[model samples]
Each structure stands twice: as C-alpha cells, then as structure tokens.
Target chain A: MQLAIVVNEGPYTHQASDTAYHFTKAALEKGHGITRVFFYHDGVNNGTRLTVPPQDDRNLQKLWSELGEKHGLDMVVCIAAAQRRGILDADEARRHGKDASNIAAGFRISGLGQLIEAGIEADRLVVFGD
Target chain B: MAQKKKFLYLNRKAPHGTIYALESLEVVLIGAAFEQDVSLAFLDDGVFQLMAGQDTTAAGMKNFSRTFKALGDYDVRKFYVERESLAERGLTVEDLMPITYEDENEDYAEKPSIHLVGRAELAAIIADQDVVLSF
Candidate 1:
C-alpha cells in the first residue's frame, strides 16, 4: 500500500516524530511505498540542521535525513509552519533577508497542498502527533 | 477527474492557548480547493471552537472563531460535534454559533451545518472516511 505520513510534533520535546520515524522505517522495510512525509506544527523543527543532542542520545534530525535519503522519500516541511518557527531553506533565507538557512538535507519546504495531494493519492495517510 | 475522497479534520483541543486549532483551519481552507468531501469533527475541548461570542481582546490573540462561519462558503458543510464531548464540557448545541450554508440543490435554501452526533455514530462516520486528519 502507498502511505503518507504527517508528523506534528518536534523532536525531544515529544515522542511523536520519533514514533513516526520508526513507523516509516518499518513500513519501508515491509516494501510498502511511502508517498510523502509531511511536517507541520512543531514537527517542522525536525528539518532544521541546528539541533545538537547529548553525545549518548539519539539524533532524530539526522535519523530522518538519512532515512529520507536512503528511501528517496518525499520529506516536506510545511513552509507556513516552517517560517513561523524559523526553519528556513537557503532560498527562503535569502528572500526574507536572513543571514543563514538551517533546513537539513533530504527535506524540502513546501505548501500544505502537498499534504492534501498526498491524502488524495496515497491509500492511507497516517498522522503522528500530540 | 479524480474521485473525491472523504477527508475528516479531527479537532481535539481548545480554541486558544495553542496553535493546533488555528493551524488545522488553515489546512481545511487549503484542502477545500481540492474539492474533496470534507468534514470537521469537534470533540473533547474542540467543541469550544464553535462557541458563540468568542472575545479575544484580553487574550490578544486573533479571534479566529469567525473563520468557521466562512467555511460554509468553501463548500465545507459538514461539522460533526460529538454529543458526549459537549455534555462533558457542560455545553449544548445552543451554546455554539449558528453556522449555515446555502444549499444549491434545494433552491439555495439556508441550512444549518452543525450535526450533533453521539460517540458511536461518530465512530461510524470516521470509519466511512478515506482520510482522517487529527489536530
């Protein structure tokens, strides 16, 4: 089955993003096609490259980026939510006259339409959040 | 043309003190453009979202409760408010805003949009949907 995932909470502060990651990984291992992974609300924070965890703790941002890269998954952070929370891509940073961009690899900034499209296209849309 | 999918926007939070309610409305507005069969479910504290006369002056937040009135214009006519949720919060349908839509199929008759339903009925409605988005 083709599945779409929506993550609505940030890492560390909530277990939502982590659970979503494991679910996506397991689904992929079972050979199911992941249509898209949409980040909204505080979940957009998962796309930022600026997070630094303790040496012994797991790094969710890196885990997501690597998973996205390996699976060629369409990992999208909602642009409206991202902007509100200060997660910016290089283009967005330049457009807004900001000095730096923090969006990590394998994740792109996009509109909410992508999420609706995913809902329409995928057989199931799974959401992980508070 | 693509077949229309049943999209349910599940609301489980209060109107203020958090961004979930507002942001979920944003998605509903955007998703309306796709022409899906959309429905909004207000349960738990989400029932407060439709409460009449919401004054955010002291809170300094945008009074987005008015936005629900505009949803009828976007062809979003189904709003399922759980009966149990309202009773738990000591609210009745009369406490909610009177949201209505013009029915084109019935000589443009103005009709109420809110549907007060029981938990069992809501579960059945949820089972009938192709996509269920929670906030």
Candidate 2:
C-alpha cells in the first residue's frame, strides 16, 4: 500500500513526531510505499536543520531527514505553515528576504495542494498530532 | 486517474487557542478541489468550532468561523457534529451556526450541511473512511 503521513506537531515538545517516525519506519519495514510525509503547523519545525538535542536524547529532525534519505521519501513542509513558524528553505528564505534557510536535508517546502494530492493518490493518509 | 477515496477530516479541538482549526480548514478547502468523497467530524472541543456569533475581535485573530460557511460552496457538505461532545459541553444544535449548502441536483435548494450524530454513528462513519486526518 502507498502511505502518506501528515505530522501536525513539532519535535521534542510532543510525542507526535516520535510516533510518526517510528510508524514510518515500521511501515517501510513492512514493505509499504511511503509516497509523502507532509509537515504542517508546528510540525514544520521537524524540517529545521538548526535543532541540536542533548547527547542522550535523539534528534528527531535528523531522524526524519535520515529516514527520507534512506527510503527516498518525499518530505514536504507546508509553505504557509512553515513561513508562520519560521521554517524556510534556501529559495524561500531568499525570496522572503530572510538571512538564511533552516530546512533540514531531504525536506522540501510546498503548498497545501501537495497534502490534498497525497490523500488522493496514496492508499492511506495517516495524520499524527497533539 | 486514481480511484476516488473516502477522506474523513477529524476535528477534536476548538477554534482559536491553537492553529489546528484554521490550518485544518485550509486543508479541507484544498481537499475539496480534488473531487474526492470528503466528510468532517467534530468531536470533543471540536464542536465549539460550529457555534454561531463567533467574534474574534477581542482575541485579535482573524474571524475564521465564517470560512465554515463557505465550505458548502466547495462541494464539501457532510459535517458530522458529535452529539455527545455538544451535550457534554452543555450545548445544543440550536447554538451552532446554521450552515447550509445548495443541493444542485435538487433544483439548487438550500439544505442544512451539519449532521448531528451520536458516538456510535460517528464511529461507523470513521470506519467507512479510506483516510482519516486528525488535527
């Protein structure tokens, strides 16, 4: 089955990102095709490369980016939500007159249309949030 | 073309306070353009989203309650408001906004869009969905 994941909360502050990450890994291990992972609301914070966790705690942003790199996943951060939360890509940062981009590797900023498209195309769309 | 999927957007929070309600509405608006079978369920504090006379002026937020009125224009008609949630919160159906849509097939007659249901019925609706999005 083709699965699409939607994360609505940011990392660390909530267990939503961790649950989503584990669910994604489990689904991939079961051989399910993950078509897209959309980051909305505070969930866009998961795409920021500036996060630095303690030596003991896991870095969720890094985990998601690494998962995407390994599985060739489409990690999309909603542009509207990202902008509201200050999560930006290189081009978006440049266009918006920001100093720098913080979008972690393997994540792309796009519109809400991508989320709707994922629901239409993927076999399942699972949302994780508070 | 892909098969039309049954999409159920689950709302379990109130409007304002958090950004979920507004952002979820954004998705619902965009999702309507896909022409898929879509339905919305309001549970827990989610029922507060449908109450009438919502004034965000004091809250200093954009009054997004009006957006629910425009949902009917997008061919998104099914809105399941959980009865238990409302009753628990000491609210009744009359307290909610009178949201309606024109039934194009029935000579464009205006019809009520909100469907008040019990927990069991809402559960069945969720079970029938191909995808369930909660925020």
Candidate 3:
C-alpha cells in the first residue's frame, strides 16, 4: 500500500513527531511505499537543521532527514506554514532577505497542493497530531 | 487505472482557536480539483465550525464561516456532523447554518448537504474511507 503521512506538531513539545517517525519507519520496514511526508503547522519545525539535542536525547530533525535519505522519501514542509514559523530554505531565505537558511537535508518546501496531491495518489493518508 | 478514492476530512477542533479548521477547509477546496469522492466529518469541538451567525469582527480575524457555503460549488457536498458531539455541547442541528447544494440531475433542485449521524454511524463512515485526513 502507498502511504502518505502528515505531521502537525513540533518536536519535544509534543509526542506527535516521535510517533509519526516510528510509524513511518515501521511502514517502510513493512515494504509500504511512502508517497510523501507533509509537515504542516508546527510540524515544519521538524525540517530545521538547526536543532541540537542533548547527548542522550533523540534528535527528531536528524532522524527524519536520515530516514528520507535512506528511503528516498518525499518529505515536504508546507511553505505557507514554514514561512509563518520562520522555517526556510535557501531560496526562501534569500527571497525573505534572511541571513541564513535552516531547512534540513532531504526535506523540501512546497505548497499545500502537494498535500492534496498526496491524498489523491496515496492509498492511505495517516495523520499524527494533537 | 487509479480509482476514485474515498477521502474523508476528519475535523475535531473548533474554528478560530486553532488554524486546523481553516487550513483543513482550504485543503478540501483544493482537493476538489482532483475529483475524488470526498466527505467531511465534524466531531468533538469541530461541530462549532458550522455554527450560524459567527462574527469575527470582535476577534479581529477573517470570518471564514461564510466559506462553508461555497463548498457545494466545488462539487464537494457530503458533510457528516456527529450527533453526540452536538448534544454534548448543548447544540442541535438547528443551531448550525443551513448549507445546501443544487442537484442538477434533479432539475437543479436545492438539497441540504449536512447529515447528522450518531457516533457509530460516523465511525462506519470513517471505516468506509480509503484516506482519512484528520485535523
């Protein structure tokens, strides 16, 4: 089955991100094709490369990036939501006149149309949030 | 040969307090372009989204309550409001806005789009869905 995931909360503050990550990993292990992973609302925080957790704690941003890299996953952060929360890619940062970009590796910024498209293409659309 | 997938937008939060309600509506409008078999389920505080005579002027925000009226124009007509959620909140279907759509096949006659259902019925509706987008 082709699966699409939408994560709606940020890291640390909520368990949504962690649960989504584990569910996604399990889905991949089960040989399910991941059509896309869309980050909306506070979930865009998961795509920032600037997060640095303690030596003991897990780093969700890095884990998602690594997972996307390994599986060639289409991880997309909603541009509207990302911009509202200050998560930006190089092009977005340049356009907004910001000094730096913090979009993590393996995640791209796109429109909500990608989400609707995921619903159209994927057999299952799973959501994890508050 | 991709078939028309049964897509259900599960809304469980109130409008204005969170962005979920508004953004979820936006996705529904956009998804209509894909011509999928779409239905919307309003449960929990989500039933407040369809409350009639909502004025956001005092709150200083865009009053998007009117947008619900335009949904039928996009050929997205199914709206299931959970009966228990409304009763729990001391609300009845009469408190909600009258949302209707024109049925062209039936001589373009007007028909109510909102359907009130029990929790079990709503669960059955969810189980029938191929894709459930919760907000």
Best by lDDT: 1
Model 2: runs farther than 4 Å from truth?
none
What ranking emerges by DockQ with the best candidate at the front? 1, 2, 3
Query: Which candidate, 1 or 3, would have the higher lDDT against the true structure?
Result: 1
Tens-digit per-residue lDDT, B93-121, candidate 1: 99999999999999999999999999999
- Compute each candidate's TM-score over C-alphas: 0.99, 0.97, 0.94
Prediction RMSDs, each to the true structure: 0.7, 1.1, 1.7
Q: For the second chain of model 1, what is the TM-score against the true structure's chain B?
A: 0.98
- Every candidate's DockQ is 0.92, 0.86, 0.68
Q: Compared with the true structure, what per-residue lDDT tens digits does model 2 show for residues B33-60?
A: 8888999999999999999999999889
Per-residue lDDT for A23-115 in model 2, tens only?
999999999999899999899999999999998999999999999999999999999999999998889989989999999999999999899
Clashes of each: 0, 0, 0
Model 3 segments beyond 4 Å from truth? Answer: none
Candidate 1 accuracy as TM-score: 0.99
Over 4 Å off, model 1: none
How much does candidate 3 score in TM-score? 0.94
lDDT of 1 by residue, A24-114 (tens): 9999999999999999999999999999999899999999999999999999999999999999999999999999999999999999999
Q: What share of the true interface contacts does each candidate keep?
A: 0.86, 0.95, 0.64
> Which one wins by lDDT: 1 or 2?
1
Model 1, chain A: how large is the TM-score?
0.99
Candidate 2, B34: how far from true, in Å? 0.6
